[model samples]
Target: MPMTKFLKNDKGLTLIETMLSITILGIVMLGVMTLFKQAYLYTVLNEDKTIGINVARNALMYMEKQNFIEIKEKFASLGNNGQLQLLVCEHNGSARYTLIDSNTSPLSGCSDIQINDRKYNVTIETEPPKNNNSDYANYFIPLVVKVTWKHGNIEQSTQLKGVLTSEDIR
Candidate 1:
């Protein structure tokens, strides 16, 4: 009779039922936490990729501002000390603006930058002019600016390509 009474008095969860429910909830919570961790990792990686693109763009802009004829020379002329020298020459109506002088470099430059504790290695490249018969082809050169950085254990890079021509429309 006492056992029957005890069985009839059951209310809410028994110890075994409570423990099982808790275990199920813990498993679900673990899955949710793992998902959140993966999402956060992707967000950080995307941020680094975007930053790399912006860095490449800024380097391209700087290249665009340099003397169009000497952009290629400057890229190839980095000194042993790792410094890019800026060459300035003024051609008053009296002389041809030729950069092939034996005493001077054609003119190319490189620079390193850091943002948000990330270091960037920037490089510029130029290729021979394509086969366009336009008179302006002599003044055209292909340009590419690349920015690279280490994002955690992986290496990331971005590039911007363009054609440089004489700044003078005439």
Candidate 2:
């Protein structure tokens, strides 16, 4: 009889029970917030990567459209006394043009690009083509384009490669 009366009077949680419930809810909310933070960070990193790759690819494609002669002419105007020479080399039985960056050393003609209000540095490197059976070097030139940017004190970069053949000269 006494137990029944006590149970009837208990209509709500005790103070300790209420505090424990509130604590558990807070912990769960903290965990969820942490997960969301990580996900957002990951998304940001992936977006940067994608942008870098695209920039490099665009640079490479631009080079691909130019033939060896055109590139030589362009570089000749840039300086180094027409030192930009393409050499033919044989590698693994295939012929390829090797790009020689003469007196310019690091070479010039790099362009800057902007994406998402962020600035990126893009550089292009050239090499002579390589092939098997022939020593003709002016047939093609290999190019590498690299894109770099600073992401929160960390440097990030991406590179893409392509070849410009003489046939492309039109």
Candidate 3:
């Protein structure tokens, strides 16, 4: 009988190849997780912005309920910067709230969110019309409240405007 040559060939991945594939997959997964984390942080920052705006608006609403003259006086005491003004006082007493920008007293149980190493800016503005009862006006003055904050690379603002009527004042 003649000797026959047997054919053989190496197939599938070796140990090193398997390890290299797993490493590549792991790197991809890590990158994805990093991206997800960044996105979540951005979302949280945005939520803060919204809350800051609402806080400012609520403050303004409280001011609106008071006498027109008292509005300016109380607001003056409160900080124009919005972030620093968390309290307003009258002859009776003072009310305390949270200032988004105020380093002295920040939101209760809340911490600052820094995205791209930038701090948020929250501002409030109250501008009354020069004329109290104009042809098309309802009140003596109009109060304008502006709230501003920064998220990532975008600057956002929310404004609340109301008219101060004689009826509103006591």
Candidate 4:
């Protein structure tokens, strides 16, 4: 255990070498953690988009199945820029439908829709038929279904367009 014998022991790492190794490992781990955070963020964003698209499609389908006569009566009262009434199904897997008038603010009653802790707002707008298509102008009901939600600080939305041929129209 003399000084000369201890200094000759090259098999073990020096104190400086061990500290440098730990510092490098820490830097590499920090970069890896950053990548994981970004991946999770993108995954959640994509999930919200997919759910928004599903909500829009379901709303469009529901409106299409209803009697055009009754729907016309509802829209007729509002005239131009009439928003269709959206009834969201039960939030807890029940088929119950609740009517929410689009004339009010989207953040009103529709705010009850919450999935995975995210609140979704759905709105349907009736657009006038295109000028180029005169035949459709009389017989077609142009509709746009938009589903909006807040993802963190940004508000994200998706829309689906559909045309319903009216049998009641002359």
Candidate 5:
């Protein structure tokens, strides 16, 4: 009879135990949600950075392909106080490039670009080869290209530098 009474005393779960399990599950779920949020943010940031890099690279390549002599002549014609301008834009999901001279009165071209509904600003700065050795100055020109854009109220930028050598003129 004592064995039968002991077997009948079994209870599935107490109120306190049920509440405690619920609380633990809630905490774990909250942590997992936080992790997921962080991962999403990281992915967005990476995408933006990748686009900026590509813009800068394309600008560099465009400059590299130009005839150095004609570039120099164009600069001279502007009295050396002008800039070589490149405008990049997105049209129907494709990028288009336009080259212009800063001296032109209607100079509407800017380094800013719009890609995939996002706006990015790109700037290219060139330095006439340093005159350390007069001959070396004639042989190389230094260039820096920067890409900038806004990300969630914060500004981000990427820069690339290269030297155009006389040997590349051909």
Candidate 6:
């Protein structure tokens, strides 16, 4: 009778082990993809907020550059309604400020303008010089430009105040 020997050998991981590893890898990949998607959305929302802020700042700068006396004169013609008519203009690296009236109410042929958006109020206030002193004595008015908007269900505002004089104009 011939003697029979049994040989046991180890080669590589079993099919079940390989499949388990692949499943774990897939789960991890899904988690990473979800994280990336969220991050991308957040970045996009932030960029929109930034753009809104810039638009408000530009509007304020344009108001600042105007001749205080001229603005005052225009307001005089506007009467009490002038404040409500305050208009915004886009210029070269700045914005334009105008006053509208009931005649222009409903903002015919106008877009990209709103009194409030994102649950925040945007405002521009002018603080004229208390006294007139012609010689570098702050003859121009101080302007308060504010842009308020909402972020993540929270309201916030960005303000830029400046004391400008005729000399500051270029």
* lDDT to native, each model: 0.63, 0.66, 0.55, 0.75, 0.72, 0.59
For every candidate, C-alpha RMSD to the true structure in Å: 9.2, 10.8, 9.4, 6.2, 5.4, 8.3
User: Higher lDDT: candidate 1 or 4?
Assistant: 4
Question: Tens digit of lDDT per residue, candidate 3, span 51-84?
Answer: 7666556756665566665554544555544323
Number of the top candidate by lDDT? Answer: 4
Q: What local lDDT score does residue 163 receive in model 5, on the 0 to 100 scale? A: 69
In angstroms, what RMSD does candidate 6 have relative to the true structure? 8.3
- Which window of 10 residues has the lowest lDDT sum in candidate 6? 1-10
**Global lDDT for candidate 3?**
0.55
The candidate with the higher lDDT, 2 or 4, is: 4
Flag clash pairs in model 1: 74-107, 74-108, 74-109, 75-108
TM-scores, all candidates, are 0.60, 0.60, 0.47, 0.67, 0.69, 0.55
The residue-by-residue lDDT of candidate 5 on 23-135, one tens digit each, is 99999999999999999989987998999999888888887777666655665565534565567645567656765664453233334577787787766666665567876
Candidate 3's TM-score reads 0.47
Over 2-48, each residue of candidate 4 has an lDDT whose tens digit, in order, gives 99988889799889989999999999999999999999989977999
Pick the winner on TM-score between candidates 3 and 5: 5
Which residue segments of model 1 deviate by more than 4 Å? 1-10, 72-111, 128-140, 151-155, 168-170
Model 1 scores worst on lDDT over the 10 consecutive residues at 79-88
Which whole-number lDDT from 0 to 100 does residue 92 have in model 6? 64
lDDT of 2 by residue, 1-170 (tens): 69888677757887888999999999999999999999998998899989989977766665666566778566546553333333334567764444455444432432246678776776666554455524344565566676788888999888777766677343
